[model samples]
Target chain A: MRDIVCEILSNKEVGENIFEMVLLADRVDDIQGGQFVNIQLPNKEMLLRRPFCLCDFDEVNKTFTICYAVVGEGTKVLSGLAVGQQLKATLPLGNGFLLSGKYNKIMLIGGGMGSAVLPAIARRNKDVECVCYLGFANKGKVVLEEKLREVCSKVVVATDDGSYGESGFVTNIAKADLDSLGVDAIFCCGPEVMYRAIKKTFADVNIPIFVSLEQRMGCGIGACLVCNCKIEREGKQGYYRVCKDGPVFELKEVVL
Target chain B: MQRRTSIRVERGGIVSNLKVNIAGVEFKNPIITASGTFGFGREFNNFYPLSDLGGICTKGLTLMPRDGNPAPRIAETKSGIINSVGLQNPGIEHYLATDDKWLAEQDTVVIANIAGASLDDYIAMGEKINESNAQMVELNISCPNVKAGGMAFGVLPASVEQVTRAVKNVCKKPVITKLSPNVSCIADNAKAAQNGGADGISLINTLSAMAVNYKTRKPILFNNNGGLSGACVKPVALKMVWDCYNAVDIPIIGLGGITSYTDVLEFMICGARAVQVGTYNFTEPMGASQIAKDLENYVKEQDMDINDLVGSLILNK
Candidate 1:
């Protein structure tokens, strides 16, 4: 990974409490779909860097987009940035999603701001028949639906309040379709509660499931050994670094 | 309106040497990456060459492979971070088989940092590391002794001396005792290491600190308390380094929240032969390299050898 100063080209609100920011950077080469960039906030008071997953990468323009939500003090500062502001970022970190599998029918599931990474996976596998399942709290919380539709073969939007596409949760809505859709692989990124629910729902189904996990980190790199997730190896459990070994792992490989 | 700026030129005659001798081992420079932060010198090597560093203290190793603590092992504070990593490593055999080869080939001193639960464990680990290619072995006494009911050996001067002397007896390489800041009298512990025939001393390891999530009325770290390191611990570390400097004659490697070139000089003036960069490495991958370069510039600008600055601080009498 390389540290470079990226100039903010645009920062705008895409949905409630969410934003899409485009940056002008010189090095955008070899950035994969599920990899993240750790952005150092301008405020000196906030010493730790904030990590955000890659939403899109424009190779020709040497620019990348990150979709973030204003959750805490760090993102609040990030959302307040204007165009032409420079952000020091360490990019292309973590082992991203493996898109080279032999699956023909891929099911991509995203919950809330986790939808930020789904577009890139869909774009990478444009030739494959990709079905996208996006969940939001309501109609106003939906984001990147149009972008996912651009690359995915089918996009299914679900909301808990039923103000948008379906009445129930995305996992509930997709449970019936997963059996009949002939899907060979599944990729999901969402809350821990959602992950547990999805794991229970798909435990009997024998498809290869991949998930992206989020954890509060000190150093986004592997040195600190703080962001650990338990994984099963040969019937024994071991801890793996979410920053290095993954931000992405197979469902069966990780304990949670 | 016209504006003019003045440029300064130099004769470029001064060639300042950054090499330092800690105990009997000589380092090319005085910037060693602290243990637990450098990760066997591979991860940061991707950003810059590891050979350029004076030394690298490998991540804390144990007799057996440890998976470390559970999730939520880290939490952020004012200007520091609290981590309960618990020294997760692949044990000694795995290190000698895999990481030792690469470490031996590097053009810098390699100090193996080892942790243990009992005196026998320390001695075993020390003997194993002594047979390896490492230049020195740092005994991390901050780890809790399971036999002693989880009381860290470094917290008491008697245990510190006992463990150090036990490991020093079998370890052929220079033994540097890494002291913890959790103790009340840090100087006594430094002297205890010296009394036990330690070649050098390195301090201060992270201070025991905690952070609470008020919303849940619970501690953030899984271990409830973790060692804190970063800019916030600099004053405490410098004072301890100074205390140890006056208390013992053995070479001292001072480290804690060291971030800049000035901090390097500060540690030197307080009588540290070398300084290790810790938490700052997370913020900037090449922070040590940059600080080393800047230190050379500072030495040239001051027209003095970097060695002359050691223990040169002026105090009010």
Candidate 2:
């Protein structure tokens, strides 16, 4: 809701082509888990702002963290910034997860860089017992496990190559214990295929499941109708703005 | 050039007069938020006041509510974006019931931009919007005419005149024909709208463009082709606006990739009485308002009335 100049506190590579950056900013008290900040890249060539989810926030330090993968030229430019550099960002954008609901056991699933937002979600819902399932392409791609463990009650990691943690997709691990774990709620963020797989795996469970989506954004705000996703409404399908209506939505509410 | 010693200052000490009159409709300023980019003017109101700009063109409304295209509706190109939103809007009835009151209460002028697949659809929408509180109706001829087998109405002068004349006959409010840039002859299209009794003309609705995902060997946008808009298209838009200006006598509302006050001046110099800020709204939510303020300062610096800049470009032939 406000544009602020954030000073980079630290920027370092946490994994292959992945980075973790902490920024010192003011007025971050309202920023919750699952919400994102649109960071204006310092490069003049790139006009559009990049949206990154809030990996974590420190109210006491007046700082926030964003974990991004260098998938494009914008992030490549972002990776070149030093600790003392400054960047303008629009913060606390889009609706975050509905964390106020009463739940004793929560299952959080993240795939690849999608795992970035899970730490913040776990941190905010400290009252609930949080179990995190993180999937990576391989052991070399794994990240944020220790960060998730700081706030989550349990952190489970999966890799396709079996080089780390368990030898399979995160859905495989979740499928085995999802019903038996007494999970009261579920939240996920990953590729479209992964979301589809998770939705099917937990179809029988009558609990609220939330998923965060990524789309090619224009304004990162709701003004541009570019980042639209189909959702079910009144027994029919309708379109929702991912930037405003959600980057996060109840699994059943979206068609996926 | 001699520097004038006297500086005329308005009530607020800004010498620039931003007010503009187009087709007998008065605007507080010349910066109108482009259609489709501004939505219902409610979303950006969260960042800045709607009253800050001269006008707001509502999202393209159709006869019936449309769900729009499928996922991956947008793709980013060099300094621009391709979008196939397909005029996803609540039908005109929904607008009159929901957004009309809110729009009427605003200090800004409300121009309803409408689209349809046929001439009847255009007339029906125009008639409905004319009965509402909107000050003007912008006929979106850029939309593909499903009845005409997908060819857009704005691509040809004959169809452009046909649709404009039909809608202008039934609509009570001033009609501004929004022309597409995908045509071979933009000037002819502008003249066609004028000949059909359009009160004003808004040009260069997104250029027909495409992008592909090389790995998948498929188009990035679900619709395969989309309209391109942003900084990348500004130069082409400026040229088209100039072309349209020379071809018609009606006031021109130039748009396409307008970002800053300078771009606004460029359009005005090319004979646009007013300009619309489109894709830039996505990058800076308060861009129109910011440009309006900057324009006041710019005119003051030049020691000239804002109107003096309109159609001032001296082409060396």
Candidate 3:
């Protein structure tokens, strides 16, 4: 809702190519799960601000954390900064995962680095029983397993190769265990390919499935119309802005 | 050379002014938020008052709602970014219904930036927006993203004149032709628009560029090549603005890579009556208003008219 300066409380690597940065923000009460912050890097020559999801937050301390992989020039420069550095941050962007508390139990599914986004969902809905399923490329790529366990009642992890936890894709395991999940809703954040697979895997299920999407952005608001995705609303297909309209959407409404 | 002024009282009772007139329309200052970046003045209003800037150019509006291009619409390079949004907008009718009333109430001058795939589309948009409260109309003859009739009219001198004339024939507001930098002679196009009764002109639309990933042997943007904008394009824009300033008699609004107060002064010295902050709006949410504030302080400090800086660049022998 506003752009303010944030000081780095902590910045360190959690897993292969993944970094978790904690910042003391001007305010944290406005943020929610599945929403993101657009950060302006320290270098003034770089004209564009980078968007990162709100991996976690402590509203009492006014601190929020973002987990990012070194994907491009922006993150490379970002990863080099030390703790105590100050940077400009725009907080509480995007329509967050509206976790409906009407159900007794809910499922959170994460693929690869997406595990970072699940813990916040569980935190937002502590009144309800929460379960999680995490998928990673291998053991070296695994992250957030211990973090999720602290919040969710049950946590399941799997690797594509047999290098860690249970073997095989997490989507496959979730599909196989669909009968006993006994949950009312499912929320997932992962690659686009995983969404396609989940749509096919959970085709006949009666439960509601929600998904979070990612895209390159400009303005990190609805203005630039850069980070747009196709979605179906009122039986009409159109491009909706991922930064403002949502980073979270119902799987049935998504055109992917 | 002498400059014009509209003076206001300062805190200590001293007089200072940041106002300038372009084609008979007065702007509070020379800092205007460029089209495609500001989005109808609502988002930036969350950071500061919309009236802080001299004016705001709405997102490029078309006749019908455009789906735009697929994802990966933006790609970043050193000091700049390339975007292929393909003129995504909610259509003129949608804007008139939703954002027009809100923008009219914002207490700032609003300029509608319009684009199209055909002459009829441009004419229809021109007539449709006249009923709205916007004070001016900007003809977008140079969007590199909307590939069809956009580039075809932008690159040619004849087509540029025809598009400007067609819109001028129907629209009641002052029409400012926005020229593209990806053309052979941008000055010729400026002159063509003036000949077609354009009130003023703004330049330069982003340069045609691309970012590639050699490992995948593929371009970064889904639409391969896109229009480039940022600090890297400032020098190129300065040259084009100066060239057009000498070639035509109408006022010029300079843009491309403008990020700060110094950049605004430079653009004014190079012959821009006003400047539009585009790529920098993405970097700083309150940037356009900040530039306006800085420019006001500067003019007050110098105790001179801001208009005196326009076209003041001294040439080398």
- Each candidate's lDDT (Cα)? 0.88, 0.87, 0.88
Task: Compose the digit string of candidate 1's lDDT tens values, residues B1-317.
Answer: 11111111254444566788987899988999999988888888888888888999999999899989887888888888898987889899999999998988988899999999998899899889976899999999998899989999999999999999999999999999999999889999999999999999999999999999899999999889999999899999999999999999999999998889999999999989899999888878778889988887887777666776677778999
Write the residue-wise lDDT of candidate 3 on B86-156 in tens digits.
Answer: 88888988999999999999888899999988888889989998988999999898743243533567888
Question: Each model's TM-score?
Answer: 0.96, 0.95, 0.96
Worst 10 residues of 1 chain B by lDDT: B1-10
Residue B166 lDDT in candidate 1: 95
Against the native complex, each candidate's DockQ, computed on alpha carbons, is 0.68, 0.63, 0.81
Better of 1 and 2 by DockQ: 1
Q: Give every collision pair in model 3.
A: B230-B257
Candidate 3 segments exceeding 4 Å error: B4-14, B143-151
Q: Which 10 consecutive residues of model 1 chain A have the lowest summed lDDT?
A: A120-129
In model 1, the Cα lDDT at residue B311 comes to 74
Candidate 1: segments with Cα more than 4 A from true spot: B1-15
TM-score head-to-head 2 vs 3, winner: 3
- In terms of docking quality, model 1 is medium
Residue B111, candidate 3: Cα error in Å is 0.3
The numbered model that scores best in DockQ is 3
Backbone clash count for every predicted candidate, in the order shown: 0, 0, 1
